[model samples]
Target: MMISSQKVKVDPRDAKLSMAHFYVAFTALALGGLAGLLQVLVRSGKVELPYGIGYYQVLTVHGVLLGLVLTTFFILGFQFAVISRTAGTLSNRARKTGWIGFWIMTIGTAMAAAMILLNEASVLFTFYAPLMAHPIFYTGLTLVVVGSWIAGGAMLTSYIRWRQHNPGKPSPLLSFMVVVNTLMWIVATIGVAATVLLQMLPWSLGLVDTIDVLISRTLFWYFGHPLVYFWLLPAYMCWYAIIPKIIGGKIFSDSLARMSFILFLLFSIPVGFHHQLMEPGIDPAWKFLQVILTFLVVIPSLMTAFSMFGTFEMYGRSQGATGLFGWLKKLPWGDARFVVPFIGMVAFIPAGAGGMVNASHQLNQVVHNTIWVTGHFHLTLATAVILTFFGISYWLVPHLTGRILTKKMNRLAIIQALTWAVGMTFMSGAMHAAGLLGAPRRSSFSTYGESAQAIEWIPYQIAQAVGGTILFIGIILVLYIFINLAFYAPKGEQEFPVGEVTDNAERTPMVFENWKLWIGITVVLILFAYTIPFIDMIQNAPPGSKGYKLW
Candidate 1:
């Protein structure tokens, strides 16, 4: 049995820690959202960057601040708060550790942002090699990664302490999900951490004249694809555990949710090769193997889809809804908390389709390196993950701030979400259409020597600018709502919704809590997938390439 509460507030101290993370996250959202708008304008050929700013510079800022900074900070903060709600309040030591981690990350973000501002690190989000940035940029990012690890320690400490205190009972669902994501994050980040610390850092500092490009890229995608899941699982947590509660439904199946998370841990890391399907140096056999693993990762996502639909349908039918689609009408459509994330859920259907296209070798060739990939990323992360984050924030921000989400703000949030939906449909749809016509990603306003195909892309680019502008408006609305909630909203008890498992659902097995078993398999799977190919790339590599400062 779970603790049943409609108005459990996170301890005030814990709330402060989580709010600190949110402040940074929203600041990143403001800056990164601005960078994103500018990028679209430049790409559309509507406006040139006025300050001698390179397109890649803005691109890096947008990707790093939004993709890395915003996601990491928000997820950590949300996790801490949720864990405090479910497991218990954090210990004095853990809370202190969280503050320290927050400061380190903030300082690191400042360092990295300063470098990007100075045009010292314009090597976009992937930071793929032969395109080196300042050493300090790498160092700053390293600290950021380290800071996250320390923060994760605080959450993990609480979870472990909970288990120690209560023998043989199932852990809280949200806490369990957080543990799974945090562990996966730790495992997946090792690849990037290795490349950065051992390879990129040494080369960037001029200690090495050349870096092995293949291995560096290999390491990146190794960290890269699972990074997708690292972002997605938190949203999934909301979908699986939190959303059900929000909509007045029990979780469809506690065991099913746990299983999907475990499957993600096992399969997400080995599938990085799908991202590298277009790159050479790896054998076709290994690429094929990893693509197969990529499909395996899809299973969990589908399971989550199945689970979410079931949760909603069950709740609907219980409320007297009938027919195949009646549940759609029964959900709380007016609640921004439900509607906003539901839009994200709908977007994933196509986003998942686009992913399948990207993962398949034959199909990937058509869209590889095209703006279609960019569109796919935006749909999945920017729309699906981000919109879900926004939905969570509506309740979460105020829930922490000791304030109620007023109806006026709730209506505004719904409008904000709709604006995002419309904007993304235009922007991403145009990118996909243009990409199929051979519009390249990561390039700014090229006419390609007046080629016909190139000219065709210009219209789609303009559409993206239109869409980007709308999305920026959505950002502003969200920030406005955030500010009111944090400082001025009326004081009240706001619930932190955690779903109860359906009565018919079977008990969650304690085996899921056996970290040694799950983690051991995770390690084995990663080793099995990467060991041979990584060695092959390193052993039979081409001459290393020297760094370039093209920007």
Candidate 2:
């Protein structure tokens, strides 16, 4: 006997949301790309801008819009899909709340961008303590955070309601990502809100003359770093769950996939301090503690990457893909989502692995606050994280529009991915070299003397600019391809109906719910954090103390 359950087709209306969100994300990328170009122009002396305003403003805009708005809404779409599926019915309330959240967040994001443009909130989206912003900036940011909080809440409620009705089966993988993202946002934003309410807002409103800056930055990074993972998890979910299915394979280990998400939720939170490793005042031992946890945090990423690639290789061989690298050819190269991760893998080997070295306390000192750090993150964020979003867009668009994507558009997207990979790799590597040579980041001018005493290397900065130009072109191509696909692609093909394909075989029902696994991981991980407060006492210095510096 065979079992059957109803699966709703993806709604055509959701296409509007996906397309709208895509515009936001892609436009943000475009602005960020322009920032890259400006940096190059300044460094190369190709064109002189009025002030550092051009670069800094763009940088601030790019980071906040891309990091907060783009990622948040895109993930919201993914959440909608999951809610529609696993919940058996997508609630009208969730649908409405999501759209409302989208609009509110968009307004907030625009205000935030305006703040940067007007130089009101150049504090960076990290919104560190004591560095107050204009009231509109904070208000705008508050709206954005609140909207996302509501959106996340809606998702959690939907999932919970669905699980209550569907009891006994583990939630589907897509839904699981939505749930995890919601949990992370809830946990992540607590710090952001606290910083805004207790620190930045108070100071900005003239309630306090001076505030504790370290505490504010500490809380902000706590939100910021894991928030990176929050954005990336949706893409990883697609990688683990959908990409394999597209390639005609099953997940290598469902349990491992579950564990991976659980670990990410737990480990990513406490380790944000790693980003501040080079700052003064923090104890060396505490910094070292974060460094160790940061390294430990890489385990889940490696595990997920290995598991996903392993699944692909196994399927490629099963489909007669032949030997080691031969699976490369056997992949569904025509599929954009499939190719995105394929290229993502190429970058991660260098970026992700090298990133581990960069995260090390000693290595970070060498590279801290340098172009190397920028390169490391851009590779990971752009190559792996943004690539995943593009992949999901490919999958979502047609499903939303009830149309099949043109093969040409998919091919071009792959080209864009390759271009981005090449560009980011070169740019980031140059930045790393510049950093190692003691070239500072966030500076519009190096002014290296003839001896190059203060500014050791200028050429690498120029290299970054050139590489950034390549990235700019790549980003433009991506946007152009997507725009054309949405507007120009003919609607002749049958709508891509959502459901498991014929090749999707019957599998045993999900019987195991190892809540203990996650709980255990949480307990073990906190053992590492338990020593944070005491770290200064034992090391004889608080974090950021003069004696506790990494550099």
Candidate 3:
């Protein structure tokens, strides 16, 4: 059975809250997309800021708005809508909690963004310690995290209410996925929250003379790696449960989907050390252990890939298609809803491969801190995740707004997705090639005093500028689509696609809902992975350094 509130439409009140989030998310996309374009132009040495704007400043705006603010708002808003659709309308208390969380997050967003624009903070997305910002910047981001926690609490309350009402019956698949992602986010954030509240805030405010740099970075990565998964799982939600419906297919296995999510919640946190492999003070023994755990994550990723392929092939066969590759021809190539996310699905192949290379100690040494790393994340988050998000908006925004996606708009969306894919190919592809030739990531344009190797990177940088221009066009199309869908599309009901599991699929086990078991095992794994390394980092640490205001 498909999970639903048994309503033909999302409650208007619930949708109001969701639309509030969309307004902010698209706004962030516009500003951040422009910042990104400027960045590439600067790097290509084709343009310079006329009024003394710093490259790092633009970089911070791009990272914080797109990476932090936009993703969070969209995921939370989308999750809230799903919970309402699948479980039931959120109760008054839950709705209020969601509203409060949104405002707090919005206010914090302004604070942090203000600081970045004023050049008060340029620490980049990592916010590594010893590169301190004003206290309000940290405080603002803290509020963002706190607001998200409150929003997550709203989700938990809804999930718990569903379990209480439904008894032994299985939870809705969409609802269940939302719960898992929220739980994972809360767990993953503890590391970053601790670093900010206990470490960065104090040191920045003069409560501490010097900060422990190694510990700060370790704590951040503890949150950082899973943070990547946090961005991804929503895209996975669309792939697992939603995309099957979009392509006119049944979900391959409900139990398999739940199991993979459980596995992800377990494996995602303990493996942050893979990101820290290049840093000093970590033991090789522990790094090796974490690397092994990191590989365990690949199992769930493969499971997702298998499920997708199975869904596609089975649907094609049912449509009277034959032979090994006929399924490819059966898919809805003209439908933006399918093709856009399908593009994301294809991008993840290289994205996932690059991730594995980065996880290896020997291979990481080659690409670590290089533009290749930048290229890798751009494919994962920028191409794979963001494209999937745009695909969701094609139906979701219309469904919520009581509008139909005009055919013209649909064709435009397809063009938008292709433009983004092509742009990323040029930009990220150049980044990888240049990085292999020893080009660095995160630095602004320079001739490096005309060194031979530095000169090797210029052509690639120009390619990136060209790609950036194309991507900017893609962003504009998406924004125009959003505006039309929200206010100007012909008024009509649009269906929100939700996949039904195959009749032959095994029943979803109640064990998947044993919160005590899953959360307990997750805690155990995190403790086992980090306790020793953290103790080692602290006990024999070298003298700390005072904060730097490099920006």
Candidate 4:
């Protein structure tokens, strides 16, 4: 049987704070969605804009605003709500720190966005070395990073204080998972922090004559792959700890769920070098090792899939259904909260398969810089991550605002999710097909002087443009639903759904909460994977290259 919690009234101040973060996140979604629409149009060679807005500029905006700003703000907001509701109210000082972090992030985003808009920082979101952006751009992003650190610090401090008061008890599952994600972020960001503060910022400011490309890229991938996990873990938290409850079931195994999260913390970072399989200057042996580690990280995902399917089977059987796949038919298909994220999980199946292909050294060569890679990540990040975020928003906004989510709004949300799925199916499918034909990514035009191979890609490019337009409309609909829910809906208290463990025969072991042990192992694994390769790169490095403005 499913266990349910009594509705707890959120503190007014905390609700408002979470709402503030959501506002910024949704605003980023709107702006970034527009940029995404324009990008596909321009790349298709079928549209032009006034005011000299180049492809790279729009691309940078799309990546930074959607990839970085939207995800960070949303995660922070969601975690704050989860922590506050589950672990009790934060101290006044902690709340103030959160507000401070918000402002810092906002100011930093504005600074970087201004530079990109002025065409001063057309370097894409990766901002790889030797193609430098303005110093302010790097500085602004630093502030954003630091702001996130401050926010995470506040959350972590609250958890520590809670643990001190409630010794010998398991922390609330949602809060525990939130802290895990925060700690993972703390560990993963060190590489990018080192790269930006020491290398990119200095070089952009002319404090350094040049910067090493290989070293910079290595540092980025060190952080980059974990960044995907950072985006993913929150969604996983919902799936494992909350979604089952929404679907009339409990999580299959709390102990196994905790173990899966712990495994993610241990395996996520050291495997990032898999992104560098095609890059030169990195040792192939090191790359192969990371590839093995990459496959290891997939274990947690498989664990999650197993737990989720088990939960579904139990629920279905409880409802008197029987058969190999009868549980699938018993799920709550009409509930927008369940359906939106359910579709995201379905999309992740293929996305995860694509990741394995990308990690393979031989397979990586075929799709390394191609649109296939673009399609792969679009399915993962855009469809899987973003769709789950939308699902969360549907309920989260209502919960924070004390609004009753009407049936009409829920229906609209379902429509939005379906629209997004349809659009992505068209766009990503075409991207993969065109990429197999040697169509390049990150280009304004792929015609290559209208060569035959390039000519074959045009239809797919046009299809991508059409798909993007549809996806933009879906995003706009989501934003609209959020605004109405937050500002205009009738006031009511919404319960936070925290799933119970189906297995009562066993308790979560104390070792699952031993974060220090996991963190130590994580650091050691990172060192083992990276230490030798980094030493080799720096010791045998060529002279660094000067910055350029090729666009």
TM-score, each model? 0.98, 0.88, 0.98, 0.97
Model 2 pairs in collision: 280-544, 281-543, 281-544, 281-545, 282-543, 282-544, 282-545, 283-542, 283-543
Lowest summed-lDDT stretch of 10 residues in model 4? 542-551
Which 10 consecutive residues of model 3 have the lowest summed lDDT? Answer: 542-551
Give each model's whole-structure lDDT.
Answer: 0.91, 0.69, 0.91, 0.87
Per-residue lDDT for 491-540 in model 4, tens only?
88766777788756268777867888888898899999999998998787
Going through the candidates in order, what is the number of backbone clashes in each? 0, 9, 0, 0
At residue 143, give the lDDT of candidate 3. 92
Predicted structure with the largest lDDT when compared to the true one: 1
Clashing residue pairs, candidate 1? none
Quickly count the clashes in candidate 4.
0
Candidate 3 lDDT by residue in tens digits, 305-329: 9999999999999999999999989
Per-residue lDDT tens digits for candidate 1, residues 137-192, read 98888888889889999999999999999999999988999999999998888888
Sort by lDDT, top down from the best = 1, 3, 4, 2
Candidate 3 positional error at 172, Å: 0.5
